[model samples]
Target: MKNVLTYACMILMLTSSFMVNAQLPSKEKQYLLDFNKSTHGEQWQNKWNLQEDPSTWYGVEIKDGHVTALKLYRNNLKGSIPDGISILSELKTLNLAFNTIDGELPEDIFLLATLTSLKLEMNKLKGSLPQDYSKMTNLEELSMFNNLLQGEIPNGIGDISNLKTLNLSSNYLEGSLPKSIEKLHKLERLELFGNKLAGAIEVDLGRLVNLKELILSYNQFQGDLPSSMATLSNLEFVQLQGNDFRSLNSLLRLQSSKLAVFDSDDEFLNMKFGANEANRTRLVDTKYEDTKRN
Candidate 1:
């Protein structure tokens, strides 16, 4: 009787595992397999056993028979992303940062309407951002810093109304700040440092009342620092060095008591302030340095 019971338990477990594997649609499974092959999965730091069930795949999140998230940060993933990635229709988050992934970003990646957070920072992705990015309405965080991307930031970026963090620093992106960017009312952190962007910041940044960290150093931006920025009471860290701005005098009226690190080209602007104001904010007016990335 003991032997029979043990055999029955093993059979039940096998059946349950089979059922779980069967839940994933065959098309989606093929998409995963293609992704593995295209990215040299066998060489990854944490690779998946293709012979096993899709649920057991590394960095893949399966929910209700659909791939929901794929996070493989710093996992030694090489080669470019497969175009079939858009087939994972229910994917909500896709993070493949700090890897050796190269080539132009697959256009299908922007078609994932369900994606809420898309992080591909510190990769070798090259090419300009797509012109029509309005489909990613659910995106909350879009970070693609430290890449070789160039061309102007698309005007369609303003359509992602829910975006909170937008970091595209250390890239070769050029052109002036888009006028449509002022539509991000919920934005908190905006970092575009170490780019080739130029022209006066004409966008109405005062609309972003929730902004906290604003870094735009090491660019070709000139003209007066917009006075509207002073209304951002939530700002904590502000860096605007390495630019040819006429003056940063408007920032002296900043109302944020939480201001800690305020980096700028002090010598270039010949900026001077009273001791009372300097002591209150502990403002650091020094040259901004670019962060070393791997």
Candidate 2:
């Protein structure tokens, strides 16, 4: 006909350029073999790889080909922890904390919404503490201290809101400590020491107005102390030691008393019960002496 329509237009333009060159380098080697089978290919420091194996592993970061940072910290990694690491959806950063890896903690890592920093803390991981962690709203820093985690601490974690440092200290967690954490207003450091949190000692935590440091030492919190905590005033450090005090004009009516070191193993038993029943025993700083001495 016309040389068979110009050889069928050069065989359909070389079969559409060989199917776009077999799909852009096979989707960049399947994104570096799905990040080298999710780090099971162990590696320490291998600065940005194209295919540079020091003895195999962690070295395959390609830009216009996908797969970003995947740092392997304190690499003495044991076994377990492989699920193609959420297929590395252009991951921002994922540090596999000081290793000795046990189990749990792989629910697709909350789908890395441009994850900030998630150090999995000294591992031996148990369960409960991952409702997609409230969808990781660009989380700041969430270190999982001494793992073996139990339950309760996930009331959608006050929806992140760019959370600061929330270290869940010494785990085995129990209940009651979630009044929406008084809505973490750009919280500073709130370390819950030695777990088993009991109730009442709340004042909506004075609405956390840029709080400094407030450690709930040895959990088992008893009641009263919420005279709006003397208006927070960028409060300094205040550790209510041990627990179950219930006196000392209830800690000087918490007009905060210039607290830089308000440690109460029972500060002289709250000053001998606010000077021997100041109000003839209305009991435990009654409304902070009826709203600061009526």
Task: Please report the candidate that would top TM-score against the real structure.
Answer: 1
lDDT of 1 by residue, 91-187 (tens): 9989888888898998888888999999888889998899887778899999898889999999999999999999998899999999999999999
For candidate 2, what is the TM-score? 0.30
Q: List model 2 lDDT by residue over 186-264, tens digit each.
A: 8775667667777775547778776665666677777765666556666555556676645424444455433344445
Candidate 2's C-alpha runs over 4 A off are: 1-119, 122-139, 147-163, 171-185, 192-230, 233-239, 243-294
Number of clashes found in candidate 1: 0
lDDT of model 1 at position 281: 53
Worst 10 residues of 2 by lDDT: 285-294
Give the whole-model CA lDDT for all candidates, comma-separated. Answer: 0.84, 0.60
